[model samples]
Target chain A: MTDRWDLSTRLIEPAPDLLVAQPGRIVELAGMAGMGLTRIGYRMLSEASRRSPMAVVDVRGWASPAAAWEAGIDRDNLVIVRCAESSTWGQLVAALCEGVPTVYAEVPSAVRDRDLRRLAALIRARQVRVVLRPLRGELPGGIAHLRIRAVGVVWEGAEVGHGRLTHRRLVLEASGKGAAGMVRQIEVEDAGEDAVHVVSGVVSRASGRAG
Target chain B: MWFPAWSLGRPDAPAEGAVLVVDTKAGVVACSGVDSDVGPGMPRRQAEALCPDATVLIRDIGEEARRFEPVVCQVEELIPRVEVIEPGKLLIPVTGAVKYYGGEPEVVELLQGKMTAAGHDVRLGLADGPFAAEWAARIAEPGTPLVIEDTRRFLSTLDVGTLSGHDDIVSVFRWLGVTTLGSLADLPREAIASRFGAEGLDVHRLAHGQDRVVGPRPIPPELAVEATYEDPLESLDQLAFAAKATAARLMVGLHREGMSPFRVTTELEAADGTVRSRVWRSMSPFSESALADRVWWQARAWVDTGVIPGGVVRIRLDPSDLSGAGRQLGMFEDVMSQVEAERAFARAQAIVGPEAVLQAQPQGGRLPTEQVDWRQWGEPESKPERSTDDPWPGATPSPAPALIPPRPTRFEVEWEGGIPTRVRLGTRWEPVTTWAGPWRLTGRWWRDEESVDRYQIVTSAGAFLCTVGSDGTFLAGIYD
Candidate 1:
């Protein structure tokens, strides 16, 4: 069956390592600041805009232009809307329902439960993917379809003889229906000057794909 | 129209970070895709520190004009006459071409399509005069055209800061709490002239859209078309059917005159002689069908609201601000779609601020951060003075960092014989298994601006880019 989040095209192209959620599906990336959640979001947003015209409603102006550039979002194709107040969930809902293919928002954590429910309902009704990157706190229940929990860097590998921590192995735990109890090994390496490529290794199929 | 960051849109290596373009005499000549806090005329070092991932390039006057040649050439092909305000901005007079094109929107759409195909993206603005047109273009999103229907109302909403070439007048206006053009125009023209002199009056006239070209142009009397109904019309559908022929005839008259109107002032007269009218503006040339649609929508809204005192007996379509003829019906669908996409993006820009949309151009710099420059979309591209061909000594060797923190993250490093034995990535500390370099990248020690002892270290947890500067050891970039 086609995914409900498949309202249109996927924002970030699905990678062997990175799981690109379907349209309208909320994937919660639970990690600390340095765990690279923002990078994943940028990657997804950039890819989505490249495939189709998209917009970003930056609630707190959190989307970095530099990161967005690295993600390869064409400025011509992308529209960025910035709002300061958490009370602006109404605007966020409006944007979600708009015809734009993707609308990524950094929903502030201080937002009340009622607003979140309203936003969730809008997302469900519109059937459009709205990537919400909360700055803090766990994502409220009944919103996220998949949750990727960062388990920190598991191993730092040195270039055989080079002795520099050039390659790193990050441990991420996937929890959901099909992906539940599955542990995946992902590799992140500095691709020189300023590009980060996340290479995903084999999943130890403690379980099959999320049902 | 105003090209916001013209220099950064160069054909060379496209830069894609916060970019600051500077000249020796002017310091920061232009900036694009940067935060508002960073602006023109800022010193180089401070700008870099403020936006650490920013790329700083000296301005190249010769190359900028050289590259701009194609844009000028493309525009010249469409209108025969174009005034180059600067490298990134151009103005084309449409008074003579409107009749040929059928409408202002059509002409702009053609030019935009042609120029874009020719590899020069431009923003278009239509107004009574060059000053307002340029402002409209500047405010318009890149790759889109902004049509000004009411110059006075539009100008009134603009900040006085939009008045270029009158910095002194602007400063004084700020001091007087006169922020918008409307407020400034409210003051007596004589008072402004007596105090600020002829220059002030020039600015005042510009604000009011009464600039040098406003009243000089003469329009033919036969450009307008009207229809009279024998019986009063009570419904919108009937009113629209009656206006259809009139709209078509108006377009034909405009076409015969070798011009296309950008704005149409439609008037409806009721049987009781009560009249209602509204002016509609289109960014691209309006076809007969499109014009009819607009009229239908207008009449429907009015009739639905009971704004008409009685059934409509008369309808008039008056077209003005003509330009060259618009797109032929058989034009490629892809080209039209591209134009439509541009128009949509421009509408989005109206919702979001202008700075949200950005374009990237590459520039020569040693650091990865310095390699690319980002500028607001449709802004004038800045040319870099320093050639990328030059060997940038002491520049960080590639592959560049995947991520450059806006500010260097300070890290505590235990040094052993000048090599980091232990370091921190975030909260956790790990033993340094191996490492490389204490590459001494010391430069501008004379100015006390930057001096660094750079090293690449690998730990059990992750890799770190460690730099020891006057401040302390800090993490600069990440590899993975």
Candidate 2:
């Protein structure tokens, strides 16, 4: 069977633009700090909520509740676990291996490889899913069934007024077992408080590695 | 069901682009169009930061309700009895109507057809209870209805965070590691009751799908009560006493059917072959004593107005607009699964202290700290104080700082020739690779307070959204 699971297929009804995290697999969204990893995580949660109930584990306290609310994740459907330290990583991973469709977490760099493998193995055994978003470093090499990386960002700052950065072109690289290597650039424009307008594949490359 | 973007579709507003509805007082975007990721309860500044193309408008609660009136009226015609949950959401008990319409599918098709004919986009949800039905409708595709066959299994997989009733109970559930409705249902009932009280028990019942759902009360023809005086009553006292007994009998029967009417007609016949009748109405459902008092008043009015002459012989009480007096139950699953969690949570929050739980929303301010507002979760609605009409000059631009230290953490900026060349990040000093600003934001200059000069600096140690105040330099947030 293919490792990638299309989450929309399992929804009560089909919906578009939502990232699906299936049970019994680990998906890692790796990116540099400030590359909108948190924003992407929230977008996934928002879409997933429409399909099935889910929770978020903020191990590094990087997610802004205000931002999460704006991203369309219903506050009533979200359970935010504010991990005070890396010690609570085990507990969060355990929570993911339960019956939930998906669980989002910002995996701190300090987490041991043994712990991550154990978590991944448990998720596979229990038929649960995990979305690992690393805060500042490269995602741990092992345990990832899918890796989505933010390679570079091209930001457009407004020349007028206070010079706010209004638009961004984020180049992404996705690859993993059973997943074809592909490069897609997303147009990230401001829509509203919680909204990040994403038009996928402004630029694309077929089966390539990031330079 | 919930119309996620009902407020954004006014005739005057642009239909295609992103639209953001701001709650002025809190200064947050109350709602947004589906095309945009901006949801309700986001600050205007933050919303603008996320969606630059979005056209922002202040939310007009009156306009939303007024625009929705025609739709509600149209639905009431098809489904004899309909409950307005809110301006966009509605509930119609389909248990009896399902058989009439031939099945659940037909009922949905019938409603959808009528609503679509009326030039409105609508969806349908048919489940065992109102809670589940609303969710089924909300999550249903734009034109289809979601009919739930098994509510128990559907609710079991939902997050406990979706449980509505008491905010503290939900918060406690989160603290206790009860993440799903199934886990909550597995908890001992008495323990939940003793620890969280009636509100808690209600949530537990909802989780287990055991809520007491009192369906729509049908208007029975036998709701009226009558009385005949054995002898012709010559005085007003005799008529009053007779009316009192008849009203009591009517109330007992109405109560047995779990209904109370808002309006009742009282009829009286005089022994001399004269007749008098009048309709009595109350803002609330009529109680036994209140109904009797109204009946007595009708008799007195007839006698005073000379509408009736001689002795009174017969009296009757006819009730109309019979409404149910018990709670409705169905989906106790989380909001994503039920769609009624907000309303349920609002009610539960009222019983518990508001401050005990909170929901983050956007409010007006130039700085990150001033922009996002947090309110007590599920508090009574309040009119917004701030309007989006005013142009806020000197506010920092988009890509809001992800982390704003509860208190500013002092940071050193090695300044050379009035330009920041190097910045400090917790012991290690790194050269500024790329940077923007020295955005001079001068406000409230008349008052002697700490003013700010902000800058966005990118260093090797993650980009920093920092501010320089009169007191010292502070880290506003990290882009990460």
Candidate 3:
């Protein structure tokens, strides 16, 4: 029943109209995933800072799998690691916050049943949205996020208007790895906890509910 | 004895527009067409056409009020209840002014002396009614006051043009065979009203010696706020007071219209006739305190830097193009916090240099890195980082660097199959991942000699790194 609810049928790709606040078409810049996280995440985080002086993180160097609980930061506002080349599929799944609409770069690797449930918990508790790409490094035994995919995004009839959904700053769901989330939907702007609740809960509801 | 009204487009002026000013009482004064400066005392139309290069600055009621505010202040110091028509005109209800300044002519002389010293060509006129006084001022001799003792007799000899209001009045007068105020006066007031409407009745009243204030003119409570300086403001402290007063008055005036200015234009009129103006813009529409703070900061910046001198004779704060309530905040905000980023930036700019503060912008380009220009905050910074994100397609997942040093690094390359087989990473020729090859990089080759070819390789030392140019592959970056 749980697998049916979130059958991993869709590939975790960057949301099309990535700028769009709603969970619309999930697709990534085709070639970007291969470029690795350390190179791109830094620039994106810095760019987001200039857009609206919020926070940024670089989680590609998670060092090892257990770094998540050990990484000493506010659990609520952690940005997920985005270094696809470094992080495994299992590591990325552990990073995602279930149903929370927090932004993540990509699932780390082919996650196990327990790790997937962990990702689902984050989604349910915090509303996480991972901008995962299907591309893998062109290596003999390269681990690709696209290998273990999710169902394609369901846009339904999301109307484009200025509302709660479009105004939320992204909650970066860092799986023990330290990837930073880039919040550019840029609404409901106050830089602390109140802002995050509005971002994840209210904005998620608005985007989730809009026809 | 005429004032030259310059609207720079008159014939004597260049192809560029000139100035035009008209003196009503002088019968005729020199008119310089927008381009022409035809001496003095010329007809308006002729002067305008003669130069054909002048642009006419119409009588700005507000500007006139502003220009004459100092004169009013000076007179207000010497008299009470000064009536202002503005734009080079005023009336001192002299029945009391005469008593205060030792009779009419002497008061007129004192007023004239003050205005003359203040650098104005003043004409004094005395009469019971405001209209009569103004008319007398216009026609009064250069050094003489035009005293219209008998209002009726004095006005009777005046030409019909003096009735000067609407075409309807002129047409009605033509029908009634009344060319002058003298003929108009002969008509009964009741009859003029019944025949030509209330305005004609007004004309008949004006024609008679019975023109009263007629219920104080409906002053728009003030359409704008203006301030005048007693002395040239040579210090930011002095400008602060003037700026505060102007902003407070402006905000109050706009409050009536339920609006505020997001962008305000400050026009600094220099003593030597140079007008320095600039518009200050903000992301969120500001409060009066915030605006004044910005203005003070702007003035401080101007003072700190030598943009404007301490010798600013007059500073006019104009809230032009004000917006309504609830304007949404812009993306690149000017730090709504108390930290005041723009002020700091301005200070940093002034002290170090204007171009000292810079922002990293990503613009569209193909080079491993395309564009990065210096910008200040609150300005929309362009994002060119995406193009550089993954510039190469099949090059073994080589993530490119956002910033490259000034010179292109040289490297020694060895190939396996068609891909770059080996690269001299830091010191020695190291074996490379043969699968991902050919990181095509093309930049200012014509401009510089450092055009590059990149390769993403998993080295024998077990490092996944991006290598560029046969120059020196100094750990462009590592992946897993």
TM-score per model over all chains: 0.47, 0.43, 0.30
DockQ value of candidate 1: 0.07
Going through the candidates in order, the fraction of native interface contacts each one reproduces equals: 0.11, 0.14, 0.03
- DockQ, candidate 2, vs. native dimer: 0.07
**CAPRI grade, predicted model 3:** incorrect
Off by over 4 Å in 2: A1-25, A50-54, A69-79, A96-102, A109-114, A121-130, A136-142, A158-162, A181-211, B1-358, B375-393, B424-436, B440-448, B458-463
Comparing only chain B with the true structure, the TM-scores of all models are 0.44, 0.48, 0.40
The chain A TM-scores for the candidates, taken one by one, are 0.69, 0.73, 0.27
lDDT of 2 by residue, B1-480 (tens): 556566665655676766777765445434444345566666677777788877888876445655665565577677765654445667787877888889888988898888777666677877766656666786789877777888766777778766543456788789999988888888999998898876777677777776443346567888888888778776776766677678867866776665677668788888888875555554346655567666776576566545567777889888865753322222444322222223223222222323423445555567776765545543333423343345668766666665566666787988777667788765678776556777877767667656688887765444567788777778877664
User: TM-score of chain B, candidate 1?
Assistant: 0.44
Across residues B1-480, which tens digit of lDDT does each residue of candidate 3 receive? 112232222234345435555542221233333343465456555665675655543333233333444556577788765543323455566777777668776887787777678766667877766556667777887666677778888777776677544555787677767887788888787887888765666667777856532332222435346665656677766776566556666665655555556556666665565665545544335556556655565555455455565456666666544532323334544323212223323333333332323334333344322333334323333333344465543322212232233333444566545455666645666665332434456555776756555444444332233445545553333331
What is candidate 3's TM-score for chain B alone? Answer: 0.40
- Looking at candidate 2 chain B, the ten consecutive residues that score lowest on lDDT are B335-344
Model 1, C-alpha of B85: deviation from truth (Å): 11
Label model 1 with its docking quality class.
incorrect
